[model samples]
Each structure stands twice: as structure tokens, then as C-alpha cells.
Target: MGFLGFLRRSRHERTGYELYGAAVAAARDPYFYTGLGVPDTLDGRFDLVGLHAFLVIRRLQGLPEPGPALAQALFDAMFNDMDVNLREMGVGDLAVGKKVRAMWEAFHGRAAAYQAAMKAGDSGALAAALERNVWRGTPAGAAAAELARIALAQDTHLARQDLATLARGAVAFLPAARAVA
Candidate 1:
């Protein structure tokens, strides 16, 4: 993280950090864990973050200019955070890579499922995906429905956002007003 750090200091990189932070914040909202019964475990938190990040990265898809680069930066920030978390959890340095790879696979699979649902404009499909990935088949009751509503709304909201704002590392997430505990 010395001189090599200079390579990571672009606007896209900065924007990625900002967006990822926003995603983490959204995931950490108490409603998701308490109301939605998201387990409040490490796997639960990762699923929430992965869900949120997928929304943002999906928004950046197919956009010209800084969109792709910013998305890639956001991805890097996520994996970097993952690396730090694993280390902090007492994972030996040698085993971190394998664990992270597993995480990457899970995230990638989730993203693919979400993308297909979004492309099909199918709420049921999205909810099914969430049921498997986020809820782990336990069923979150009304809160699960609320999360699906939130994701669709957030996706629409993010789509309406100006690229200039996103390029500056600025993202505004909609409130979870539709869902209550």
C-alpha cells in the first residue's frame, strides 16, 4: 500500500469505495437483520453486502465511459474488504485465498441469478433467487417480500441516477420505507 497504492487512486477507484460503503451501510440497516430474519451471522452479512453490491454493479452495466471501470473498482473494494475481514477473523494468511475464492463463487452465482431475473423483469424470479441465496430457504415471511420490493425500487432508482453523480462516487439509496419491522 505504498507507491503501488498510487495505481489505485483514480476517480473510479474512489467512486468504488464510496459506492461499496453505501452498500455496506444499506446492508447493515437493522431492519434487514431483525425484521427480515437474516440470521445476523457472518454468512448473513456477506449475503446482504453481496445483494447490495449487485444492485450497484448491475446499474453500472452497459454504461459508457467510467461505468465499467467504476464497477470494477467497486468489486475490488469488496474483495479487499473480504480479505481484511478474513484476516481479522484469525484466518491464516495461507488459507485466505481459498476461502475468498469460495466467497467469489457464491457471489458470482448470486449475481448471475439476479441479473437474469432483472433482465426478465420478473419479481418472482428475483424473490426465488433471494430465497435461495439470502434467506437460505428458511423463508423470511413478509420481510422477504419487503426486501424484494426494496431491491426493485432501488434498482429503478439507481437507473434514474445521473452518471455524473455516480462518477463522482456519489450514490443515493432509497430508504426502506416500504418495509417495516
Candidate 2:
């Protein structure tokens, strides 16, 4: 690519990283772990990140042109972070790719489930999917429903945001603490 093309690509990558960072921050909210009863383990954290990423990506998919590109960047940014995290956690070099691929499949499946549930306006389906994935098919009391509510709220909030703002990597998630109430 030429200079301008390289610059544009770099800018998109930077925005993708920023957006992914926002999703991670939202996923790490104390309310989700402490107040809502989400497990505090690594897998739990991954599920939360996947949830937040799905919210952003779902909205991005509906826009024109640069929307798809930005969505791809966001996906790339997320997997890149996962790859780095796995390495940091001392996964062997060869194992990292396999692990990342498994994670990729998990994220895709979860995202698809979420998209379908929300599109059909089936909160119960969303909750069930959350329970199965987030709670590992174990009982979670009201936590799964609460999480479903929060995810719906965040999705609505994201849907209203302008593409331009999102393209600039300026995305905001509704506070999970308030969503629980």
C-alpha cells in the first residue's frame, strides 16, 4: 500500500484497538463479577469480553462501507489481544494457535446465538444462551437474566450511536451497575 493507504490502515487499526479496549473495560466492570454473580475466573472473563465485543460488532455490521471494515478490524484486534494474553499466561508457542482458534470458534458461536436471540426479540433465548455459556450450564439463579438485560440495554445504547462516532473509536456502554436496577 502507498503512504496514504498505510496511514488509513494504521488509523483503522488504532481505532479498532481503542474500541476493543473499551469493550474489555466494560466487561471488567465490578458489578458483573461481584453484584451480578458472574464467575471471576478466566473463562468467565472471556465470556464477558465476547459479550461486549458482540454488542459492538453487531451494530457495526449494519452500517455501510467502512462499517464492515471497522468490524473486521475490531475482530482482528480482539484475537490479537487474546493471542498476546495466551502467550503472557505461558501457553507454549505451538499451543497458542490452537487455543486461539478454539477461542475464535467459541466467540463466533456465541456471537451468532446472541445476534439471533436479539434479532428475534427473544430475551429468554438470550438468557438461556448466557446461562449455558456464561454459567457453563450450571445454575446461576437470576444472574443470567440480569446479564441478558444488561446486554440488551447495551445493544440498544449502541444501536443509537452514530457510525461516525463509532468509526472514530468513540463507543460507550451503558453502566452495568445502573442496568441491574
Candidate 3:
């Protein structure tokens, strides 16, 4: 099947398990690994990030009312993975670390508000949350933007230049993107 066909068929699954399985399979295969330049080692955190990204996309597509705690957990997972990559690359001393942390906290706060709005069926609140601090200029913002694009299929709304810059940064730190793609 074509890529779009796979996505459509996968979306039809009634349970998250099927979607999660497909996502994990995709993440493990060389197709995604080569595209993202992720290492084959089980210890590589990028693989986990990729899997979580797929899971988040599936959950959002299913429109399941994931509680605030669940959302927070996912956010924390992604943030932690990015932090690990940053530290390994010796970016811990850069101001980018502080900026990235602040951006993550802001994103988490907005995401919680968004989840509450979703549960309340409050469109206004959702819109407001989306509008506020959706993209801060930091590594976390780039990761969040990538996740948002993956989850929402709304890539056009993200800052492309910033995303590219962040992707380059990640590639430099991870040393896999250059080799993968």
C-alpha cells in the first residue's frame, strides 16, 4: 500500500494498540531510521522519541480525551529525551539549555490548558491556548513544533526556518541525521 493508504488504514483501527504497533514497527524499521538518521542501538533515545511521536499522533488523530496527566507524561518524556541528547552533545552549558527548559514548561502549561479546554468542549479556550506561546525560539520549541506537525498534520503553521535550524542542531548533537539522510 502507498504511504497515505497505510496512514488511512491505520487510522481506522478501533483500539490504540493497533496504531501503537504500527508506529513501533515503523520506528524500528530502517525506513524511518534512515530518514531520521537514528542509530540502531537499543540505548539510543531518539528511537524512543520517534515512537512516542507516532503514538502522540495516533492519540490525537483518534481524538481520545487523554487527561492532563497523560499529556504531561508524554511532554515530559519528549523533553527528557531531548535533554539527554543536548547534554550528550555538551550543550548543557549553552544558554539554549535554559531557553529550551523555559519553552518546555510553557508548552506543558499550554498543553494542560488545552487538555482542560478539550474536556470542557470549550473551543475558545482551545483556540486561546493554541495561540499563546505555541512556538518559542528554543530547542524544545523545535521538538514541540515537530511533534505538533506530526500529531496535527499542521506543518504549515510551524516556523520552518526555526525547525530547520533546530533539526540541524539535533543532527549535530546526535551525529545521526547526517548519516541517515
Compared with the true structure, all predictions reach lDDT values of 0.85, 0.91, 0.39
Whole-model lDDT for model 1 versus the true structure?
0.85
In lDDT terms, which candidate is top? 2
| Residue-wise C-alpha lDDT for candidate 2, range 61-144, written one tens digit per residue | 999968878888899999999999999999999999999999999999999999899999999999999999998898876889
Estimate TM-scores for all models: 0.91, 0.93, 0.33
Off by over 4 Å in 1: 1-5, 8-11, 179-181
Looking at model 2, the pairs that clash are none
Off by over 4 Å in 2: 1-11
Q: Is candidate 1 or 3 superior in TM-score?
A: 1
Scored against the true structure, residue 22 in model 1 reaches a CA lDDT of 94
Query: What is candidate 3's CA lDDT for residue 139?
Result: 28
Candidate 2 vs 3: which has more lDDT:
2
Best by TM-score: 2
Instruction: Please write out the lDDT profile of model 1 over residues 120-146, one tens digit for every residue.
Output: 988888888887888888876666667
Better of 1 and 2 by lDDT: 2
